[model samples]
Target: MVNFSLEGKIALVTGASYGIGFALAKGFAEAGATIVFNDINQELVNKGLAAYEAEGIKAHGYICDVTDEDAVNALVAQIEKEVGVIDILVNNAGIIKRIPMIEMSAKDFRQVIDIDLNGPFIVSKAVIPSMIKKGHGKIINICSMMSELGRETVSAYAAAKGGLKMLTRNIASEYGEYNIQCNGLGPGYIETPQTAPIRTPGHPFNEFIISKTPAARWGTPEDLMGPAVFLASDASNFVNGHVLYVDGGILAYIGKQPK
Candidate 1:
């Protein structure tokens, strides 16, 4: 049987205080993996801890900035010491700036790239050596739909995610021989609290999304859990350097013709 069990695994998900990252970590815990997560501050870490506890999951939470190379290295070392070698890593920490390209400042653009692209590079670097030694590993980069498509006011975000897509492929190329699989999990417009306002009935943006998607609905955090688990488990041992987009067929469909 193709094994999908994450038993005896240690999974580290970044920025898991809430939203998609939290959902992924919760799923991992349910699959028998020991959960380890990090946030940029103590408050978020504490929040994540409480959330995990409320879900009956004993998760290890830490405060670490993924964009800081030194901090990421140290965090990896600490996790290794405290929770066994990290068997799975989900680079889920990122930010997006939706300013138009001309209006967006270079500083703001760099910030997006720094976190979405470089942060993954830093954290993945910190964990790969141990994974190589251990003979197998999985690294899932939380890429976005912007990785492939572009929108009017999301230039920086699109650029960052595009770079991340390539980074995911490159990591797999460089480390596949070591039994390390690096892939991208690109989520479509998911229904998170942050997007709740825009999702109300009759909202133009909501209608736009619903019309564009072939599935005719927004995806939920739970929609991503199974795919995350599959990529993290032995079932996907041969699936390396591929991006599994959970975009509800948006990427595959063209919008409906005007009535």
Candidate 2:
């Protein structure tokens, strides 16, 4: 039998209070891995814990910022003490600013880069040591379609995600010998709370996304569950430094001809 089970694994997903991260963490729990998550503050952590509990999963939650190296280190230590050495890490914490490039301040750009790019770097560094000792590890960075394609008003996000793609590859290259696999999960046009407004019927962005996507609809958070599980499990042991784009085939298709 192909071994896809994570019966004795521990998974830590950053910013799993809701949305894609929550869905992925829940999937891990369903796969029999012990689930741990973190948020930036106590409030969000509490909320995430409650949400996980609501799903009948006793997820361990903590308050930590992935951008802070010391905090991330401490968080890993605490998880190791409380739950177990992390077997899987999902770098799902990120933020995006929608201001046009020209109008956007450098401070704002750096903030996005710090959170989206640097956060993963910090967290991954913290966990790799334990993983090295354990002889195997899986790190999944939640990259975006912006990692490959550019768009208007999201200069910083695109740049950070682009950097993250390279970071994912570099980690795999440097750590593959240690039996570690680093990969990226690229989500495209997901329908989340943040995107709910734009998805309203007849919205230009919605129409644009639909037309661009061969699937003809925005992807749901649930759509990523299987991919998340695969990347986290032994199933993808040989798959390293790859960015699996769950974009409903948008990247491959050009678009329908304008009527």
Give the whole-model CA lDDT for all candidates, comma-separated. 0.95, 0.96
Candidate 2 regions off by >4 Å? Answer: none
TM-score computed on alpha carbons, candidate 2: 0.99
Positional deviation of residue 152's Cα in model 1 after best superposition, in angstroms: 1.0
Can you write out model 1's per-residue Cα lDDT over 129-155, one digit (the tens) per residue? 999999999999999899999999999
Superposed model 1: Cα runs more than 4 Å off = none
Per-residue CA lDDT of model 2 for 145-234, tens digit only, reads 999999999999999999999999999999999999999999989989989999999999999999999999999988999999999999
Cα error, candidate 1, residue 198 (Å)? 0.6
The per-prediction tally of clashing pairs is: 0, 0
